[model samples]
Target: MNEDITRQLREAAEAHRPDRAQMLARVERGMAGPAVRHRARPFARSGTRVALAGLAAAGVLATGGLAVAAIVAAPSPSPSATVTTPATPSPAVSSPRPTSPRPTPVAPAPATTLGSSRPTPPTTSPSPSAGESQNGPLWSAGSLDSRSTIYWTQSNLALKTTQPLTSLTIEIRIVQTGAVKNTGTWQTLPSDDFTVTVQEADGALVYRWVLKPGRTVPAAGFEFAAQFNNGTAVRSAAGDGYRVDAQGSGGSASVRGGFVPTR
Candidate 1:
């Protein structure tokens, strides 16, 4: 019995055994198919991941070292630039200068002349048709003549107004002459022997006589002087009273008489 069973098993194994070449061809085909390729993708992906993690770690270390070197080597900012320092102002100075003085203007004095201070007095001219003197007397008849007469006991002398007259005045002066060493000297009598009349007429005035008594003429002769004003006429009998002898005894005693108009 055992021998029959063994022969039957061998025939079955031989009949069921697989082909190596055919099995290998099928494995290659499966690998080439979607299912088998999908199962193997995890191994390829795991290898790529490890390589990328290594590269990233190297980049991190290099970047960190460069940053540290820049931090250490860079120059510090200057205090002037960072802190903003303020500017300083400059000081101011002043200077003084000298000045010159201006000149003052002078004014000129006024002109003057000599001998111009005093003024001249005025004079009047007399009328020519009146038959009067061209140069009038300096004083009036009343100023030059007297109204009183003197008297003496030895002779009676008189001055008389013998007619009516207007604006009349008379002046009389007595003179005496004597022989001394044969040289005749004539002198006016003293004021006691003279008479003066000063009269002004409203219309006319008349007088009969006025007398003066005097001593007789001695060895010395005598002379008389008479003057009258305007519009006066005396009596012919009184003419002797106005006259003095022009020729005296032996020419020793002489007289000169005349009429002079008042101014």
Candidate 2:
């Protein structure tokens, strides 16, 4: 009977335990009351794997960019590298020679009425001739008046009979009709072809001619003059009238003429 009573007391204590919901509420209260704190767990190993993979990708990109930049920065070589070249500075590009300025053309001189270097025969005066003067030959056709005149005469003396007369008188008589422009004189050559003197009338020398070598005697009115070589000149009438000693070969055929001033 005592053992049955102990068993019944233990049954009564078990039947009186708190309901399950109420027990759960008490456990929640204890948890929320700040009696404990929860901790986060360490990251998964797979996440560490992902992070390592991303680092590897960034390293690859950086390495590729560096390699490309190095290649681009490299220098290139010139084509003539192998040749030993002269150091001569590139020939200064000589500025193309400035073209010589074209020369200005000159105008030709005009035609003139003035006489040529060659001598010309004196024009005869219109006045009547005075008979041969006491000085020499008789005046037959030309006048010794102020107007310039040229008088010529043939010698009757034979070349043998006549001593060579190279000298002759050249008179210039300024008559009432004579003009002052007639101021010069000349003695004729023995050849009867030319007349020359230092002055036409005390003028600068002018060689006057009636004939030239290798040329024909001019027409009756034609006349011209040229200078002979210095020694070639025969003595002239420059003194005491123009005079010359004639060469002996030709005699009577030797002719004489005088150039006289009229002014």
Candidate 3:
């Protein structure tokens, strides 16, 4: 019952605007005789609600000269006017003195970003977990590093092939989430065994690793990782992807896929 009354009161208060015309009408209605109020006991709750709302509204409306209206509506005797004269104000005291207003509050700074200490809830939709996707002969998997700070992040890519490759090129594209820039890259394979180039094109940091002449990707697993700056907030890698084009004794085979999204 208390909750019901509170809900009704809020609804009534919101419906009642603190305005002049309604104030006078309410005042006249509220001035009913005691006998009339006694006969209206059935509507007691509603009456009390309006009366309380009207009192609160009066307090707010009084700031807009409702007090003067009250004086005019119910005039007092001439002696009451004389009584107010003695409460006179001096020019210096009442000439719109410079009152010091409360200083406007400043909002606190935004969240200072850093790597998540624990597993943090992602901001984007849940995606396939890392080590989920397999593309062609090149069994590929990807995951964002746990040490990724807000301003910079790293995505690790793992590649595996069942067949030894005579020629291979690995292309990893880091989707342009925000302020993305490649800091550096590394791989499990010998650095001299591959020609690596990192460049920005088509709104992404494109990292390409070509098996150097005569140097081949083995049948075993290999790791090719790249690190880049993501920006000041957790990022999503929905569009980020990779492609592997390789030629073995069997024939040329290719596979392409995107990195799972992350926050």
Candidate 4:
């Protein structure tokens, strides 16, 4: 999978659809207060400057060796509709920018590294005094791109540990390598509704968007297109993002910074 890391994972999957449509267009143009504290840090710094321009175009597509044709492909999720979620234990924010702006456009350098496994960097809860009543929906980005295969799943739960809540699910899948078309399975459901950390407007960062028990819309967005080889963990540019949800489920979500590059 090297065609410049599949074109920098297709420009980090189209730069997360315009950095999530400019954070839903700045929450419908209200300025969204500092864009919600740098929402996903400019789409994780434009997904590491387009993944370092896909490692400098993977050295000119690996010296013009290129291999990995079969463009356009992302659809595979029907294995009896699965989608599970109920692990818990993970929270610490930071790392997820490039939802838009600029600084996220490059493609003339190489020095990559990012082999998954860096999340886990968010902690600092405090707020729940006035009459007490807060839970869920602080950060929950769903995914399930389609075409032939491509699935994703994300949850930060916002360093949870309050106690007294319920409902949570986050699942994703996408399998399809060969066999023209006659052997498939694993297309689960239950996509959103973590509860949105109960409105989340204060300091922000308390999310929820679960749905895996039976699903009614499971597949959400971002199907395939991701790469990060070489050493990995590029100086913790952006880390923290892995929380299942459960255990009294008080709810929370806050990952302030973002950025991850190495290869």
**Each prediction's whole-model lDDT (CA):** 0.29, 0.32, 0.68, 0.31
Name the best candidate (by TM-score): 3
Q: In candidate 2, what residue range of length 10 has the lowest lDDT sum?
A: 152-161
lDDT score, candidate 2: 0.32
Please provide, for model 4 over 1-263, each residue's C-alpha lDDT reduced to its tens digit, 9 standing for 90 to 100. Answer: 67688777555544432234554464456433563465568889798678657655654554343222224244444579566887896896779875875686677432211223222211222233211222343323321111111221122122222332344432212111221111111112222432222222332222334544433321121111111121222212122222343322344332222211111
Candidate 1 — which residues are off by over 4 angstroms?
1-41, 81-263
Q: What are the runs in model 4 whose C-alpha is more than 4 Å off?
A: 1-204, 212-239, 246-259
Query: Measured by TM-score, how close is model 2 to the native structure?
Result: 0.24
Runs of candidate 2 exceeding 4 Å displacement: 1-42, 45-47, 58-174, 178-182, 189-263
Error of 1 at 142 (Å): 56
Give the alpha carbon lDDT tens digit for every residue of 1-263 in model 3: 97686555555554545666876776678676476444557588688788879777666755434444444445456574433546556566457768998899998532223332222222232244554555556677666655466686656676778888989998889877657877777677888988999998988889999988887777997777677767677777777888888889778887666655344
TM-score, prediction 4: 0.16
lDDT of candidate 2 over 97-170, digit per residue (tens):
77898999997432111221222333343223222111122121222223211321111110111232232222
- Candidate structures ordered by lDDT, highest first: 3, 2, 4, 1
Candidate closer to the true structure by TM-score (higher is better), 2 or 4: 2
Kindly provide the TM-score of model 3 when superposed on the true structure, using C-alpha atoms: 0.48
TM-score of each: 0.18, 0.24, 0.48, 0.16
**CA RMSD of all predictions:** 39.4, 26.8, 37.3, 59.6
Worst 10 residues of 1 by lDDT: 177-186
Q: Which stretches of candidate 3 lie over 4 Å from their true place?
A: 1-136, 261-263
